[model samples]
Structure formats: C-alpha cells, structure tokens
Target: MDLVSTSREALRIGAVSYLNSKPLVHGLTALEGAQVRFDLPSRLADDLSAGRLDVALVPIVEYLRHPEYQLLSSACVACWGPVLSVKLYFRTPPEEVQRLALDEGSRTSAALAQILLAQLHDVRPQLVQLPIGDSIDDVEADAVLLIGDRAMQTSDDQFAEVWDLGDRWCRWTELPFVFAAWVARPDLPVHASQLADVFDSVRDRGVAAIESIVAAEAANLGLEPALVRDYLTRYLHFTLAKREQLGVELFAKHCRELGLVEASRSSLEHSS
Candidate 1:
C-alpha cells in the first residue's frame, strides 16, 4: 500500500521520555499527522499491547511477546559497549546477589540483568519490583537494578560492584545490545517505510543538534553538559542494522532458554 494513502488520521506515537531516548524522538512531533506521547519504556510496551498506542519505542523483549508487531528499520536505543546507563549496583559480587531490587520502568533491562547473572554468574536471585523515582535504599535487597536517568546517577562510592549491562553484553557476546526499538502493531494502518523514514530523519536531526540537546538535557537532569554529550555521542547508538537485528535474535534466544518468554519459543521469528 502507498504510504501517502495509508492513513490521514493522526497517528498515536509512543515515545520514551528519557534523555537517552531524545535522539530517536527529536522533532518527531513535527511530522505531519503524528501525535506523540511520552512514557516509561515498560508503560509504552503495555500501551502497545493494549492497543492504546499505534506504535511505540518499546523494549526489545516486548517484541518477543508480540512477534506479530513490525519492528521499524534503522532506529534503536542500543550500545556497542559501555552504555553508561542501565546498570546493576551491587554491594556484593554478581554471583552472590541474594535479593535484587528491580526498577519497574524497563523490563528489558531487568531481563538483561537476569540473563547476565544466569549466564555469567550462575546465580538466580530473588526479584523485588521497585518504584521509579524512589531510591532503592529502603528496599531490602543485596543488589539493585536501575535504568534511564537514575542509573546515570550511580557512582563507585555507592556500590562495591557496578555492572554496565551494555558493556557486559558486548564483552560476553561481542554484539551490540538493543535496548529498545520502534515497533508497530500488526493492524496499524500506517506505512512502515514512511514511518521508518520519519524516525530515521528525526534521529539524524537529533544527533546533528547534539550540543543543544546536551545543554537542555543537562539542565533538565542536573548533570554536566559534557557528561551528557559524551553519553549521547559515545554510549548510545541509534541505528538498527543487520548486526543489531542479530543481537536482538540472540537476546531472544537467551530469553527463551531462560523461559522469560513463551510465545517466541516456536517462532524464533523477529522483524528485521
């Protein structure tokens, strides 16, 4: 179907509001016929599943539960190494983590933490869901999983061992880990190619205007602009390519092996 003829109604777009996500969604609202709403990654995934969002920047693991959804091309929140965000803060070694306080904001990161522990440490810790914005200080857990802005706030003084999941995945699998990607529902009327083009264009513009983005985000998050710039430029990867797709598949395989998802067990199919 022709993209122009697909739909004239406003498209409901789900976006992650984190500073790390700004690049992919920058100027997205400027696109014609698009209505953008921002929320946490996990909420976005729920909205996508519940039909509240036509498309969403959702966790990669969300796709395994709904393989019928189409993954948009050339846009992702990924990292080749050392994402500097999405971290596991532990007072003990990875293998000795007895109780874990998990951030409910991102299930993908939570799953990644589990996958890493199981594969690398052979330990299965008890999981406790913790609310966002509140510190894990009150939670009685040996380790805590934090993502997005909170993860960036972590320092060596706070934890005996801080594991950057992106760096760990890269070192362990030698593949870029895709944290999130734009996914469209099977029945959405929008044109996939047109949507992909819109997202890619937004990403390019966002990266080009990194200085302004850095300044704004730094002020908003109370972080140094230089740090923000380094994070955006050095850590986060926006492109979803062949290698990234393979990475997603590998992640799915791990998820399945650990019984994290059921629907993907037979299909093993993912949108490229």
Candidate 2:
C-alpha cells in the first residue's frame, strides 16, 4: 500500500490560485499522497475535463456543465453577500447600461448576472469577454461584471459605485449566493480517503485561520488587509444549505430557458 501510495505521485488538484481560494486549500501541505494545483476556475475546468486533475475547485457552472462530475466534500468557496468580491460595476444607472465586460474567471456569476438581467430586471448589456491584464476604464460602459480576487481588489473609490451581485441576488430572491465549488470525477481513484483528508485539511486550516490568509493574500494582491479581512470574515461562507441549493436550481432553470445550456441536462443541480 505504501508503494502504491508513493507511485501515485502528486494528485494535480486544481484551484483558483486566488486570495478567496487560498483558505480553502491552505491545508494541502498535510495531505499525504496528494499534491494541490492552482489556476483560474476556467483553466481548472478544462484541466479536470482533460484528466489533468483528480478533483478541483471549479466554477459552479462548470460542474453543472458536466453533471457527471461529483462533489467530494460539502465545503464550498462561497459567500452570502460577497460585497467587495462578486460585484457588478455599473456606470449607466443599472437600467440603461449597454455594453458589459464579463470577467473571464467567472462562469456561474456571469450566468447568474444574465439571469437577473433577463428575469429579475430586464437588461440587455452586450456581454464581452475581457481577459485578465486587459486594460479598460470603468467608464467604458454603463455596466461591467467583475468576479474573483480582482473584483475584490478594485476599490469603490475607483468606480462610481459597485453592486454586490451576491447581495443583490439575496435581496431579489432571499438566498445565499453559491459561487465556486469543489468537484470530483466519476471514476475517483481508490485513494479517495486521501482526497477527503486533503479537503479536511482545507476546511480546518483555511476557514479556521482566515486572518493570516487575508493578511498574506491581501498584501500579495496589493489590497488593504483590513478590507480583505472584513470581506472574508463577514461575507464569505463555505456551506450549502436549503436556500443556496434552491438558488442554484433557480439559476439553472433560468439558464435552460435562455438556451445557454443544453435542455436535456440541467447544470445548476449541484449534488455531491
């Protein structure tokens, strides 16, 4: 068994490589027979699909995109009303906003934003894919959707105002926002216990020791440590309950109606 474990090499697990995700994977050092990998959620999804990872913290919709994928643990890298992180910045009074830039790190948030645009409030902003490191002014459009660490790092003083998508979704639907999640493939390796142990380490070290994470990660991103600490502690959550689950389902239904996803299969249903 020891030889088999040694032969396993590194697990090549995938993560966002962002401040928000560091806590979820902070305990990877303690997991035996497993090595963690980090990248954007899109890259994580692509790698996981291509068999580069045993599991990953993929965007929620990516899991829905391939429903055959399984969730190994209940813990998620999510939040209730992630004010500074998952926000949609608008220059056009929210109603007349025309062109919108879509954050490449996002899949579920982009979809949820569209759902709100079409269903909750009639919006038709031209969604443009803006890659990371692309230069664009906040005044370019009436609205632009931003996600992940970059969104959190963007100060309100830099923009006219920021709308927390998670917070707005809560006010509109009264539920917690389900963002990124951990995923496992259908043919999980026999060393699954080690996988569970890895996640156990993440939940214990990452969630429990958030201040250190916020301090370190905020500094790396050139953001105020205090602001990052406030967001991580007051906004983000790791558990999925009845309402968040329902919100997932609701978003899935809306996506199906918009023809964004194949109707034969539903991607919003996040089941472990």
Candidate 3:
C-alpha cells in the first residue's frame, strides 16, 4: 500500500540521538507522513521490537538479533578505521581483564568489545553496566567501553591501554564495521522500497550538508567544528556497499559463534 495515500497516521521512526547519527536524520523532521523520535540506540531497538516504532536506525547487532526485522536503507554508521567515538579503555591488560563496564547506551560496541577480546586474547570478562553519565572512575572494572560523544571527549590518561574498536576490527579483519542501520519491522503499512528511498535520500542530503551539521552540533557537544567535521567525513562511513555488506555478514557470524545473537533466520539484504 502507498503510505502517503492510505495511512493517515504518520509512520513512527526512531533514530539515534548521537552526533554520528545526525547525518542520517538531518532532513527527517521535514519529511511529510513521518514522525521522527531520537533516543539511545539500545532504546530505539527496544521501541522497535515493542511495536512503538515502525522503523528505526538501530545498532546492527540488534538488527541481527531480530530475525523479523528488514533492512530498510543502505545508509548506515560505519567505520573503515579508527572510529574515535567507540573506544575501550583498559585499566588492565587485555588478557588479564576480569570485568568490563559497558556503556548504557550501547549494544553493538559492547558486543564488539567482547568479540574482539575473546578472539584476540582468549579472554571473556564479566560484563558490568556503566550507566549513562557515569565515568570510568565510577566503574570498578578492568575495562570500560564508551560510545558516542563521551567516548571522544573522555580522558584516557588513567587507563593502561586504549583500543579504538573500529580501528582494531579493521586491522584484524580488513573489513569496515557497521555500527548502525535503518531497519523496519515486519508487516509495515507502507511499501518498504518507498521508505528505503526516503531514508537513502535523507542520508545523501545530510552528508552533503556536513558543514552545517558540524556548525550546529559541535558547540552542543563541546567539540571543535574541525574535529566534528573530520569525525563525520573522514572517520565515519555512511554507505553500505559490497565491502560493508561483507563486514555485516562477518560480524553476524562472529556474534552467532559467541552466542550474542541467535543463528540467522535470514540474510541482511538491503532494499535497493
């Protein structure tokens, strides 16, 4: 069915509130027949699963967990290398880490940290929650995983070692890591293809308007515009092409092996 013609109620869309997601949602508010809400990535996943949202830009791990979810757009939050925004600060060596504090807002990064540690060092640390607004000082773990703006701003001087999960993943696997993607719940009132087009168009426009996004968001995050610009343009990758698809597949495979997510019922095929 054509959503614009048949649905009187606006499509409920959930998006991440982090700076990395701004480009994907830049023009979303102005789109007719859609209502956009911003929240933490994990919260968005929960909302989408509960039927509160028709679609969401959710963490890729969440998408892999839900077999019914459909890939709605090719636009995503990915990194080819050195994502400065998703980091792990280790107070102990990787092999000696006994406990890990995960950012409350993250699911993908948390899972990625575990996967990396387990794969490289054969260490599986006990997991702990690092509540939003809580710092490394508050968590009495061997390591802490932080994502989004806080990850970029937090000092690493107190830590024994730091790892940029994205950079490490790329160096280890030579593949781009997809942090988040636009996914729609099953049985949507609108055509999936149409919705995908809207999302892709919004992403293109947002990427083109990176300068404006930096100018508007940098001050709010207490970061320099130059840093924000480079973070968005240089460090982050938005398109989910062939190599990114391979990354998603590889990530899902590892997640399944680690039992982080169930065995895949279907492949993550994107709408063209």
| Superior candidate under lDDT, 1 versus 2 | 1
**By the lDDT metric, which is better: model 2 or model 3?**
3
Clashing pairs in 2: 91-142
Error of 3 at 124 (Å): 0.7
Candidate 2 residue runs with Cα over 4 Å from true position: 1-9, 138-140, 157-161, 191-194, 263-272
Q: Which is the leading candidate under lDDT? A: 3
> What does candidate 1's lDDT look like per residue over 1-272, in tens digits?
12336787778899999988999888887777777899999999999999999999999899888868887757789999999879888988888998888998978999999999999999789889889867868688888998999889767587889889999999999999999888899978776777777777788898898899998999999999999999999998898777887788889899988989886633323343
Structure candidate 3, residue pairs in collision: none
Candidate structures ordered by TM-score, highest first: 3, 1, 2
lDDT of 1 at 264: 65
- lDDT, candidates in the order shown: 0.85, 0.71, 0.91
Q: Give stretches of model 1 more than 4 Å off.
A: 1-5, 265-272
State the weakest 10-residue window (summed lDDT) of model 3.
1-10
Give the lDDT ranking, best first: 3, 1, 2
The Cα RMSD of model 1 versus the native structure comes to: 2.4
The C-alpha local distance difference test score for the whole of candidate 2 amounts to: 0.71
The most accurate candidate by TM-score is 3
